[model samples]
Target: MKHILRTSMLVILIIILAACANDEATSNEEGNKDEGADEELKIFTTVYPLQYFTKQIAGDQASVESILPPGSDPHTYEPTTKEMVEIAEADAFIYNGAGLEPYAKQISDSIKSEDIKILEAAKGIDLEAHVHNHEEEGNEEGAHEGHNHGDQDPHVWLDPISSVQLAEHIKETLVELNPEQEEAFTKNFEELKGELEILDQEFHSQLEDLPQNKFIVSHAAYGYWEQAYGIEQIAVSGLSPTNEPSQKELENIIEKAEKHNLNHVFFEQNVTPKVAEVVRKEIGAETLRLHNVAVLTEEDIKNEETYLSLMKHNLEQLTKALSNSKSGDSSESEEQSDSDHGHSHGGDEEAQKIYDGYFEDSQVKDRPLSDWEGDWQSVYPYHEDGTLDEVYTHNAEDSEDMTAEEYKEYYEKGYKTDVDRIVIDGATVTFYKDGEEKFGEYTSDGYEILAYEVGNRGVRYIFKLKEEKEGLPQYIQFSDHSIDPTDADHYHLYWGDDREALLDEVTHWPTYYPSDRSGDEIVHAMMQH
Candidate 1:
């Protein structure tokens, strides 16, 4: 009886110990689950747009923070030690390239970990060449020979299309960092691109029919606009506000304002308008404000002003100033004119050519796929992973149609490569690399490639139908997006209904390599072709 009681007590104690161990294990698992839910990718940015863009694309999947405080100028702002520490701890650092942030390169180099990725948000963008005036230099032309004096316009985010590219690049980086959230990032990016398209249309509609084409701006930040639209930006200051205009330069501006009958002297809201006020007073013009968006004000933050809203504001001001000037009264003109206000470069055919290379029109939707059907082929490369890194090896002597220099260079590089051909059968696009159907029956989303190959090299081709118009021969325009000029040559193919004509037309197809041309140059070439 005593032995039986003792064994019973021992069994009871063992059950209690087991129960306690299970409870502890359950508590630890719950803790781990909570930690996993809270984990997020940390991203650090140099400017407000980069932060805004990352947040929009990353959504709740990542934490996007800006190093530049609200209302701080990106050009002149310096990061504190706290911000540097944050960068060190971040998973990635994204900054606007083209020399906008002086400290970004240094901070990136100082980071010891190879795990942290540093991305140039503006990478692959074709920056505009801006002319900078040196305070010590007298002659404008010869003072800077073969040198632009750090005058590449870094404010590419101002343009809607360029902003789209920047957003895509950001999404690509984020996807690479945390591929688990690629679907989320891609969906968000598409929505953002749609918004940008709408913004682009608004600009086109508002400014397309304006009477005056030129506007005097506070600074030379609108070169992208000048390139996109025909609207010329005459800056009172150079690229940076630091390049204050001399008395003679101000006098020239006043004279031009009078000649063009500009009724408003434009000033940046972020910058003090003292100099612009002087120009306005001398020219007797009213003061109008523009936002550079390099920095935001306290009010801008409260109002939730984004890149789109600020750009729209700019459009409103531009439309009012340019349109109102055309029908202004003599007194109104006089109020805006300087003492010697007769110097005007009136709208001539030569002046009109400035608007020639705009590609916004070419980006319009294609004819519905049901309307026609045919096979279209082009020399395009692809990979299993869809990376362009293999182009150096894969772009060798592949086809008879390959350019001489391209073939010889890669051939001597000892890379025996086969040319990949892209064949469009009806709405289905097939990518053939080295005689294998790497990607087949890929349906397109209208004219845009819904899913395509990319890595390292930057370029995209759009097949457009000219709609059987007289004198406007139907052709497919290959839009190249490669930021590097030396990567590969993109071409445009002109062919009618005859499928056999595609082969013969290939000989006449214009070859555009990145190294041989600028974005504007390529656009002009396509237009001229």
Candidate 2:
């Protein structure tokens, strides 16, 4: 009995000791808040991907936060006051600065904290404006940017070798901040480098001799990949989600599409690339997709899509685009002088205008007969639970009958189909979609959210602007980047405020969609919401 009692007492002591040890470790990891331990270093990152990277390197010795909110469009985004405060309080602020976030410089400039360690997450590569993500830039015509000119496409992190360089940067910073962890930091860095090395090898091996070099992407987001590899990104436009081309420029792109024997002209998942649809029909290209690692939606984040996943997805899209890519003949090698690429990435406004100008008008430059007179409106395909019950045009037009040959039967021909949006007669501001009647609910301009769906019926935006009023300026037109699914409906509809001009844009066909009618469906439905 004495022995049993002794064993029980020892066990209790051991348990207490373990608890104390754990508590001590937690304290050390978080920071030496207690009277006599080492304090943990603080770490802050611009986005979740960087947070993941820092967490891997810092382990429990650092705290991390992604400044951008979930689903927030990181590009063209300005941080809130609260975010600015948190940034000021951080010990280290890491951001990808190869022209990825044009606002990063702004945010950094705004903050007065010079003491905080800043880590520009790119390594090995330095870009000025936009690099050669040729395929991606050409696909959207204009999507996802406004940072640098054509020299610095700061997406080097997309490449594995550069990502390793980033890891090294993180390690060096951590060691500088906390010299106590020098040995640990060195070991971690080595291991991390090894992993990165393996990843880089995998990428090289997978992409080394792929039969194709060009592919369509949603934006001007993948220039680094092209520089690192042989891939050519054919984006719809140059850099800057804000750029839009004039009619002549649009025609040149279409001519290039045809001349290049291009198969696809892609767009992004979140924001609509309104400028793409014109080129899509002109060259009869296929619709492909590639994700830019700026800021992913909740679904992508939850699925844990890393830079690796995104790059792999890009490879898959490339596979499809290259199938029809024009071969680079012998002449391509002779003119390869050290040509200075003075490509100014002045493309965002122009790109947005592609959507705005065409969708805002009721004229088709290519086709003038098929006038889509139905009101184009935005509909909330997904409810609060994020479940989509509405039958999208892609799904709705999936029957085998709407083949290209038979499409002309009911097709209204060429009339620039424009989606018309008007704020309520007098109120704060509201917008509607598909020409919904404007009244009670859609009377506030505060809820303008861009939404899209993809399938055979081409890509579409279900715009919602109910709270808008007369005092508010017209919201931007953004339905031009329609996805062109081979098997989708050909009865393209355009509902806009103008009629004759809209028809003019569509009569030119590939540059615009044909529409036959316009209505109050979109505005009325949006107002009811």
lDDT of 1 at 209: 76
Task: Residues 427-515, candidate 2: write the lDDT tens digits.
Answer: 11233436553332211111112222211111222222344444322322222332221111122233334433333332222211112
Q: Which ten residues in a row have the lowest lDDT in candidate 1?
A: 334-343
Error of 1 at 295 (Å): 2.0
TM-score, per-candidate, Cα-based: 0.54, 0.51
Runs in model 1 deviating more than 4 A are 1-38, 131-149, 326-529
Expressed as tens digits, the lDDT of each residue in 1-529 for candidate 1 is 4433443444444345535554676778766976765588899988777888889999998888888887776766667655666676678999998878766766676563555788898878887876443221342432121122275788888888898999999999999888888999999999999998898888888888787888877767788887787788878776666566777777787778788887676778667546677877776665566787777777576545787777777776777667756333222111110101111112334322211211233333343221212222232222122222233223333345555455334323221223234433223333344566522222222333221122111122334343343422233433222111111223333333433343233223322222323333433332221
Q: How close is candidate 1 to the true structure, as a TM-score?
A: 0.54
Q: Candidate 2, after superposition: displacement of residue 478 in Å?
A: 35
Best by TM-score: 1
lDDT of 2: 0.48
